[model samples]
Each structure stands twice: as structure tokens, then as C-alpha cells.
Target: MLITQCQQADVALLEEHLPSPSRTSFHAQRFARQGVGTSTYLVAWLADRPVANAEIRWNGCAATEVRQAVPNCPEINGLSVTEPLRGGGIGTALIRHAERLAVERGVQRIGLGVDDDGNPRAAALYARLGYRPVVRYLDRWSYTAHDGEVHDIEDPCVFLAKELTSAPTPDLGVRVQ
Candidate 1:
């Protein structure tokens, strides 16, 4: 599999691989953000097809608390692998690649927000990757659907961050659970 930061031309691949009715333009938006240098849209391609995707937001997560807790850390966001392709190391590779990219950009730390109440497996993965909890926050955000209808989401979450260069973060709370 080949992982590459997506350009404007790759939005079609992201949508083609993860077809979602309500998520139209999501890929385009990510590409646009990449265009402006605020983020990077990374796509994992296997056999000439996109198999997984994630975005690295240089400014951290949308949650105010998360951003405040881990300022200047690039937050890995929107990581997803097709349901049929889960547990195949695709997601893991994508994350590692993201971390490497951050390191290349002179970033010393990286972060990601895991849905605390709904995703234990992800939390476990982050722990194994050396990310520790830094802050627990409500992930409050919104997006516009393809129909232009705004949708809001509120999920209980914890911000996990890892050092890329031996620059440790002071422990903020309990282990991922």
C-alpha cells in the first residue's frame, strides 16, 4: 500500500473509496484545507485504490479544551478505514505515516481525540502507540451535509498525545479506558 498526502486531484479517490451520502464534499473540504496549508489529507492507496484516509490538522482538534491542552501539536483527525478492511494494519500504517509527516515538518508532538464513550479499541491502539491522555473534553462540532443542512455532534472524548522526539508531556489524567 502507498500512503500519500492528498492533493486537490485526489478528492475523487477519497469519495470513491468511502462513499457516504451525507458526507458529500467532505473530501473536497479536506483537500481545500490542504491547499491552504492548515492541514494535510492523507490517503492510503492499495492496488490503485484508496483504502483508508486521515487528516492531520496542524492546530489540533476542534474541541476548545483539546486545542488548549495540546497547542501546536498536529492532531490526527478523521481516520477511517472501510468496514470490510478493518484490522488489517491499514489504519495503523496510516497513523504511523502521519506521525512521520509531522516529524518531517519539525513538529515535536502529535495528538488525536478518541471518542471516550464509544471507542475502546481506538483508545487501546493509541495507548499502545505511546499516546497518553492529556485532557478529557466534549467533542462539539458541526458540518454541512450535501444538502447544505448543518448537523451537530457531541461526543465524550479524551485527547491523547505522543512525543515524536522524546519531549514528554506532563501526565494529565488516567489511562485510556
Candidate 2:
């Protein structure tokens, strides 16, 4: 699978391949508005079909606890994989790509908030990926939908973080004279 930053051309592809009510287009617009290096919308493609997607926000949002814990860290948000393809490591790939992007931007840590009461599987996946729970907080946010309806969100959330470190270069075995 190839993980790539969402491009204008990929927007329609995402709408075609991903589930309905998908936020891929919304995220793509946000990425465009925020410009490169500030925000990102990533898509995981399997054989040219988008299978999963996620976003990274440099200016953290919501998750008051996460901001208190790591004020300068980027947060990975809106991680999603197609319902039929959840267990295939697409989510993991998206996360790792986010981390790599963070590291490239000179960020030392990354954060994300998982709903404690909604999806424990996501929390478990974050734990397995080396994120440690740092704080618990009530999440509160609101947004406008395409249908001109405003939606409010409030959930019990756990903020998790992982410190990023550069990987050591592998040494090729060779005989030295």
C-alpha cells in the first residue's frame, strides 16, 4: 500500500472509493487552506484505491488535556479506515506516516485523543503503536455539516503521546583490512 498526501486529483477518487459521508474532501480542503508543513491529509492506497485516511494538525485542537501535556506537539486526528478493511494495518500505516511527517518538521512528539467510551479498539491500537496515555479529559467541539446543520461533540477522551526519535542507520557487515 502507498501512503500519500491528498492531492486535488485524489479528492474525487476518495469520494468514489471511500464510504459515504466520508470527510476526505473536507480534510483535503483543510489541508489546502492550512498549506503544506502546517497540516496534512493522508490517504492510504491499496492497488490505486483509497482504503484509509488521517490528518495531522500542527496547531493542536480540542483535547485540552493533550495541549496541556504537550503544548507544542502535533495531533493526529480523524483517523479512519474503510469498514470492510479495518484489520489490515491500514490505520497503522497512516499513523506511522503521520509520525514521519512530524519528525520531518522537527517535532519531537506527537499526540492523539481517543474516545474512551466510544472505541476501545482504537485506544488499544494506539497503545500497541507505542503511545502512552497521558491524560483524560472531556472533549468538546462543534462543526457545521454540509447540510447547513451545526453539530456539537462531547466525549470522554484519553490523550496519548509518543516521543519520536531518529532510527539508527543499519550497519552493513563488511571485512575491514
lDDT for each of the candidates? Answer: 0.80, 0.76
Model 1, range 80-144, lDDT digits (tens) per residue? 98888888777778778778778778898899989987988888888987899999999887876
TM-score of each: 0.86, 0.82
Model 1, C-alpha of 7: deviation from truth (Å)? 2.5
- lDDT per residue (tens digit) for residues 132-151 in model 2: 98888888866666676777
CA lDDT for candidate 2: 0.76
Query: How well does model 1 score by local distance difference test?
Result: 0.80
Best of the candidates, TM-score: 1
Number of clashes recorded per candidate: 0, 0
Q: What is the lDDT of residue 30 in candidate 1?
A: 83
